[model samples]
Every structure is written in structure tokens, then in C-alpha cells.
Target: MNRILATARVQLAAWPSTLGMPWLVLGGAFLVNLMVFALINTSNEDAHTGGLVTFYVVVLVAYVVTMTQYFPMILGMSVTRRTFYLATCLMALVQSLGYGAVLTVLELVESATGGWGVSLPFFGVEFLQQSNVLLQLLAYAVPTLLVSSLGMFFGVTFKRWGVIGMYTLAIASLVVFGGLAVLVTWLRWWGAIGAWFADQSSLALLAGWPALLTLVLAAVNFLMLRRATP
Candidate 1:
């Protein structure tokens, strides 16, 4: 475990450690979330609709951005592709947990102050004090993992500066949901990347399928990684 962790750390350092990207993504997530909370509370119908857009956009950005950091870093390393995949998976889990922790705190504060209500599916977390903490965490985890796996695939395919694809995915997700708002719907091709994090039902089904898919995809990544000339 320590070796893997150490390896992961070393690999991470090889890339630019500027706080710029991390801050940009995290700040964007929080800012978009705040807007959603405000919008949903508004009585305006437009606000309500806007809130949904906000929600999907934030989820897309958060998932893609968090996973983006790990993908290329893994490939840039001298490690085996399997090891790289495992490392990316572990990193993704940790990143999701971190975001989940912060989001839970925000939901609680909102519920208590009547600022903006946050709810969870598995548990009825309508109020700050009554919110289902575990449920809240899992709710966030759904999209996080979904984005991570999909982002990993992107990263494995495009090593250096691959995070650019994450940004593209985020923008594309925003466009899809936004387009749907106009009632002029089209095929959601790129949003499937966002689907890793934006699934609305049957989380167990979602998780099981994505996890299996990630393994298969990661195996492919491993093969590609082995053949990749460093």
C-alpha cells in the first residue's frame, strides 16, 4: 500500500504542481453549487430550471476535473498500466470522498440556516440536523466515480496535458443539459462521459456496471500503456 501510495505521489510530482488548476476546478464546483442552492430556493420557475442546469454543469466539471489530474499522471510514470489504473482508482476514490465531506458540511449548514435546502435520495435529508450524512456522501460519490472512470479513460488515451479533455467534457455536458432546457433535445453523446457522475437512478446498478466497465477499460489502458513508448 505504501509503495503504491509513494509511487502515486512521485508520479503526481512529475507533473506541474501549480495550485492553479486544482483551485480553479474546486472553486468552480463550489461556486456552481452555491448558485444551484440559491436558484432552487427561488420561487421563479426559470430559477428552478436554471438550478437543474447548474447542478448538471457542476457535477460534470467536478467529476471530470478531479479525475483529470490522475489519468495522465499515471501514464507518465514508469509503472505498469495495471498499477497505473489501480493508482488512478484509489486517487479517484479519495478525491470523491474529499468533495463529499465538504458538500455534506455545506448541506448541513444550509438546512440549519434555511439558506438552501439539500436532499439525498437514500435518506430524506431535508433539514440540516435531520440530513442523512451517509446518504449524502454516497449521493455525491455516484457522480464522482462515474466521472473518474470516464476521465481515466480519456487520460489513458491522451497522456500529457490530457486534462484538456476533461475541460472539454465539462463544457460539453453543460451544453447538452442546457440544450435540453430549450426543449430542442439531441443525442447526448459526450454526456455519457458525464454519466459516470450524473446518473439519477439505481445507483447500485450504475456502480456495478461502471465498475465492471472501468475494469475492462482499464485493462485496455494497461495494454495501451505497455505498448506506449516512454
Candidate 2:
């Protein structure tokens, strides 16, 4: 347990990239959206900017880079694979919660200010507009976990398999998805699938599945790391 904490501390040492950059990007995106919406319309009606998507995408890339950069360093320091993996999971959870709190606050502020006084929806998107604070937090945090885990999975994959493996993985993934699409089309399940998705609560759709995926990816990442080399 101490070792895990120690390993996590090492990762946390690079706080600017892991913790600060995403929020910085989000703030910048919000300001840009605010300026654009404020200047263009000159109206009182609310607008949906969809700018928060940029922040989420950045978060995903951040985790990938985190793993690719940090894993080798820690491993070379003689840290056990298990400890490093556990530390990464810890970091992902902590960072997600921290970012989620910030996002929740921003959403509340956005609502209070009436979309920054111009009806722009930077933080408060239609689908994620939850009244329950916890749900809102989950909505924001779960995706972070999922994406971070995804990035870590890819990072470890690249470490273990190299460029050729990545290319192979990408091709395999495309084939798998394409096969699934074809199957869905042949079975005429698109409508039912759409209905199933629509029937789910927003929390279930956004948070539940992503949380499950995160766990699965974490497990897979650990497996990869167990046999991985620096």
C-alpha cells in the first residue's frame, strides 16, 4: 500500500500535464465560446456551444501521454508493475473526481449566469443537465475514468507491442466494429438498439457503461503491464 502511494506520488509530481492542462484548456475553450456567442448574436436567448467536448477530448489524450511517459520512468526506477498499475488507477480516480467537481461548479455557475449572460451552453449540455449534484458529478467523472483507462491501455499496448502492434490493433478494431455494424444492419436491430439507448436513463447511458468500461480497461491494462517491458 505504501509502495502504491509512493508510485502515485511520482506520477503526481508532473502535476502540470496531468492535473492542470485539461482545466486550462477547458477555461480557454469556455472563454472562446463566451466571446463568440457574446459577439455574434447580441441576444438574450440561450445557446448550446458544445465547447466542453474539446476539454473531454484533451483529457483523453492527457492520460495516454501520462502512461506512455510515466510508466517507463517508474519501471526503470524498479517499481513493481502491480504498484505502478495501482497507482495509475488511483491517479485516474482522483483526477476524475477533482475535474468532475470543477465541471459541476462550472455547470452551476453557467446556469446561474444564464449561459454567461448570453444563453451559451459551454458546461451545461442538454443531455447532461442533471439536477442531482452527485449524478452530475458521475456524468462528468465516469467519462474521464473511461477515457483515462483507454489511454493507459493504448500506452501500455504501444510499450509492449510497438508501432506494428498498434497498427494491427487498429485494423482489428476497425474490422470488429465493422462486423458488428454489418450484423446490426442485417438483423435490422438499429431501431431496437436506438430504442434501448433511448429508454436508458441519462445516468445509465453516460456514467454506468463508462464506469464498467473503465474497470475492464484497467484490468486489461494491468495484464498488459504485468508482462510489459520498459
Candidate 2 deviant stretches above 4 angstroms: 42-46
lDDT of 2 by residue, 1-230 (tens): 99999999998897887788888888898889888987886564444677788777887888778778888899899998888888888888998898899899989998899777877877889898787999999999998888888888888888888898799999999999999999999999999999999999999978998888888888898888888777
Tell me how many clashing residue pairs each candidate has.
2, 2
TM-score of each: 0.53, 0.95
Give the clash count for model 2. 2
Worst 10 residues of 2 by lDDT: 41-50
Q: State the lDDT of candidate 1 residue by residue for 1-230, as single tens digits.
A: 76568666754563333223443555565566566655555543222222222333444444344335544454565555566556656765776677566656765675565444432111113321223677566555545566556655554445533457458767888998787755533565556746854664444443456556756765665565555433
Taken over the whole model, the C-alpha lDDT of each candidate is: 0.51, 0.86
For model 1 the TM-score comes to 0.53
How many angstroms is residue 65 displaced in model 1 relative to the true structure, after the best TM-score fit?
8.9
* Model 2 error, position 205 (Å): 0.8
Clashing pairs in 1: 143-197, 146-196
Model 1 / residue 2 / CA error / Å: 2.9
User: Which pairs clash (backbone N, Cα, C closer than 3 Å) in model 2?
Assistant: 46-119, 47-119
**lDDT for 112 (candidate 1):** 68
